[model samples]
Target: MTDEHPQVAALLARSHRLGADPRNTNYAGGNTSAKAAVPDPVTGDDVELMWVKGSGGDLGTLTTGGLAALRVDRLRALRARYPGVEREDEMVEAFDHCLHGRGWLPGGEGTAPSIDTAMHGLLDAAHVDHLHPDSGIALACAADGERLTAECFGDTVAWVPWRRPGFQLGLDIAAVKDANPRAIGCVLGGHGITAWGDTAEECERNSLHIIRTAEAFLAERGKAEPFGPVRPGYEPLHEDARRERAAALAPVLRGLASTDHPQVGHFTDTEPVLDFLARTEHPRLAALGTSCPDHFLRTKVRPLVLDLPPDTPYGETVARLRELHEAYRADYRAYYERHAGPGSPAMRGADPAVVLVPGVGMFSYGRAKQTARVAGEFYLNAVNVMRGAEAVSSYAPIEEPEKFRIEYWELEEAKLRRMPAPKPLATRVALVTGGGSGIGRAIAHRLAAEGACVVVADRDAESAATVAGELGGPDTAVPVTVDVTSEEQVDAALRESVLAFGGVDLVVNNAGISLSKPLLETTAEDWDRQHSIMARGSFLTSRAAARVLTAQGMGGDIVYIASKNGVVAGPDNIAYGAAKADQSHQVRLLAAELGAHGIRVNGINPDGVVRGSGIFAGGWGAQRAAVYGVEEEKLGEFYAGRTLLKREVLPEHVANAVFALTGGDLTHTTGAHLPVDAGVAAAFLR
Candidate 1:
């Protein structure tokens, strides 16, 4: 579709090139457009049309479907109907009326025009680019940005004083461009930059030139350590210690951020973040907040900066964090009260989206891992912008009242409302032991499919990674290798889950080994091995998870995959059966103990699950088959024949049971056993 329209193709190509570099634009931060002459389908006459990146679309991965097409004449005429600045939001609705050919696309649907549509459509040039590059924002954020613009690019790029994005801002930029005949672009005060040209190639070149020139200017004039020298005892901790501290603090920060709603988290200790946190001026700069709309929208008005140095005692650090969290929320609420107007949208969450710790790192939170990660990335961009601005001149963002207006704008609220409903397990984080294969693998996939970030823990590293990849890679699922029987390994796996996705909300204790032997043949070593893997392993995993979940103050689920053999005594299964029994009792015990903290524990009892069963294939099948007087291949059939339903239970059946126990539906029902067997009466609970 893009190929059929050369101008549109050029627009997309240019947008992609600019968007591909973080220095050019933040993710989904900016928009681009092209005006083309197209023959009207009905009139058979050339008519001017404008195609611009639609709302919520990222330029780098944009498609034809993501572009909103509007008639240029209709769009231009909007200038006459434009209400005063106070009612400028009405103009967003006006954009719909300007749709070209009813804005029909590949599937006869129209994309929503972004607020910046006017900025593109109102410009006189054939191609226009509006970007939020760090360098451009640095110049935009400087206290003397207008003067800096003149010094950086002379009269070629004009400077527009700060105006909240709306139809008015578009008119302001267009008027500035028209008044300055030689102006190729303008630095938007405390926002970003905009550039235009008659051709897409020229437009892209101008945008790059503006960004590079700003970068060069800042580099040449910037002072050493713009954030100021690192304070004593504020240097970043050692690598191992930094990560350890990050992991330790991630859950606490995530919990605080989730005071309004559950959120996943991302942690970063990069050089820039560390240097900034170590600086004496960071708290003051951070308090002023990010200048660009895109930056603040993700990072919030400001970050919660930990005042204590990195080497402070863990207990003391945690205590200070809690105190800071309370104060931050109170301050946020006051900020809202101070600026909120009658027509303003209701205040959303008061929790800080970004948390900065000296010597450790920054922790960013959102409803999902990707959102959290991108928020952290945006803050990193903010850091760079502040650095450059502070180096050449004082860093000055828009006033708090202006920021409040944008943050609580009705259009932004409408955008939030337009977002799709979250999945059932959208904010959940699950860790599945033995997640590499069989029952564990199925459970991992199920949880991930329902939108939970998953931690695939298995003894086999390759298998764990394979399953994690199948579940959609790092953002959705991460792989952790662990020997469940080892307490240190179990604790480490939980730590990995915490670091990867903030905290664990669901735990599946499914790692087990099977060995079948007659009473006379069963050895003490076999019994101890089975008990250590299944029974003690469950205890260790549960204990570790309980600490994290308790710290989060959020309820969680723990499901143990016990077996029907635990209740129904069978020949040559003493070791495996006893281990299963231990797991069953542990579920009840933990359920009783942890109920005060809202933690639920449950178990699944399954009959022989032969197909794709790692335990069955590892010699246990032949042993069980011999006891049943059947071939190994017929074991499933033989087991099913003895049951009321005469059905063979599969791994998916157990997976389904896990979901039922944890997937929000059975929230109040725990400390019980779900039977996935073919209705074996002997195994049924009394």
Candidate 2:
């Protein structure tokens, strides 16, 4: 109980505070550490240990369990045993032996140490922080970075030349510290900042001082308009025009970004991004690529920038983007071949993670929504760095060979291999109409569980939002309000879905209304409303989604929740029955037409879902009961008794059929209808 406990807590607190602001560090881009003395469990003597942020952890959300603890003496002693930079990767595996009896946590279990562990353990300080702050990287990437470092902090901070991160780089920093006794930290050229102190508070202060001083240096001496003046043809569009343009281009860009694998998408048109894209030097700087490993790893070596003017014809603009996409993929493949060694990991993917559209915004893609969003953020950081460096001096990142090495490093491959397998629908995005309640809600929940990002669309905004929240908030689900009867609202809802999740890969047309009335009693408005909400609604949603799906060239699915009444003759059900029948027919027509484009269209026929149904609760139950001469409360039982299986259909049962129609195994079974009514013989598609 000496100062060890408090020191560990202090490390976490310091890490959190530093990481809270994006200006301090990008997501999961840095590490922090502390050295402490604690009593050894086996022996009565005090043992010195170094606790550092473990691999794959984000400092802002770090916990005690996310730390790796190792014996400081043992970590430093490896310097003598280190073969050289040639075999630095082997040292990572050796870290296991240095662990302090499995780990230093309560159960002696902790996260594995990251590659940056050496920098913390080898430093002769009680506390250390390494961060990828944009300001620091701005100076680090400057062509005259060493001179700028000296000018920015004088003797307070030292400069170290670019070197791949590993055990050797740690020793190099220690050497710089030994030479400059008054230096508080050192800037790792072409990388980020590393600072240390005798205490946690002092270490935090040193890190901030280095970051702020670099920021101030550039502000004072940097030239105006670092990216050069805004290009004449690339001015940002008006706000409404901008988002409209982004929505139009996102799916195409998303498709291009998914050349390697399916990816979710994120869009950002912040002032900084729009400003950068409007500048003349953006293309030049972008081609040079990002400096820090963290930036390029997430954003790719460089982004795919749209070269044409924003006001170009729509067809022309799309053609140019597709051309650029092909060139980017070719370039990426060539880059992989140029530097790949026998032992290097295989090229991960040829897709560009970030796409830059002049006047519109930036679009980034990843295997998940959060990952895509973070990639966009990291590119923003890169933009800031490029501006800062270009203002004071030329921006020059590490050579291409070095970037290739890091991107395909064997150790990084090992880390990726350790990740858990993805769920069935991991990279897919789904849009479910009427998803606020009943069967639609169940479909949203089921889709999210399979790892797809879900968009809940309903005329009721509140219910849609509530259902989306239940499905795990914005990360996994988003809500959009739409009245399917209005074409404009339907189009807007589809656009919102694209914005929320890059593009739609699955569409569920489930919104409907019911009226239990004889043909003579049914009014014209009733027929129109039912048709508008079911047949027409499905058509509008499917048509909009078809545009995106064809643009993506990726296979997709469309599911129609038709009713048994669509095929079975029923009493006093003329309007609702005709509308349902229309929907069932539309599904077949679309499946046949879109089959060439790899879009599967199918329908689900269910008996009256009396329980947990919005339609049933909205007076449909009592009306149906009266028509059948049964009590409203016993409607479900009556329906169940008529089915061969005698099982009442539930919302979840309908959801299961949707998944079955779209899930991987049903690839060849399109244009077919699946009955989820517990065996309604009359409704069977013969």
- The sequence of per-residue lDDT tens digits that candidate 2 reaches over residues 1-686 is 22337778899899999999888899998999999898887897998998899889899998877888899989989998999999998888888788886446755557988898888888898999999999999999999999999999999999999999999889999888889999999999999999999999999999999998888889999999999999998999999888888888878888888877999999999999999999999999999998799998899899998898788887899999999999999999999999988877878899899999989889999999999999999999999999999999999999999999888888888889999999989999999999999999999999999999999999999999999999989979999999988899988987898887799999999998888999999999988889889989999999988999998888799999998898999999999999999999998999999999999999999899999999999989999999999999999999999999999999999999898887789889888888899888888888
The C-alpha stretches of model 1 lying farther than 4 A from their native spots are 1-3, 102-110
Best by lDDT: 1
Model 1 residue 97 CA deviation in Å: 1.2
lDDT per residue, candidate 1, 460-525, as tens digits?
999999999999999999999999999999989988899899899999999988998898999999
TM-score, predicted candidate 2 vs. hidden true structure: 0.98
Candidates in order have lDDT scores of 0.92, 0.91
Supply every candidate's count of residue pairs whose N, Cα or C atoms clash at under 3 angstroms. Answer: 0, 0
Clashing pairs in 1: none
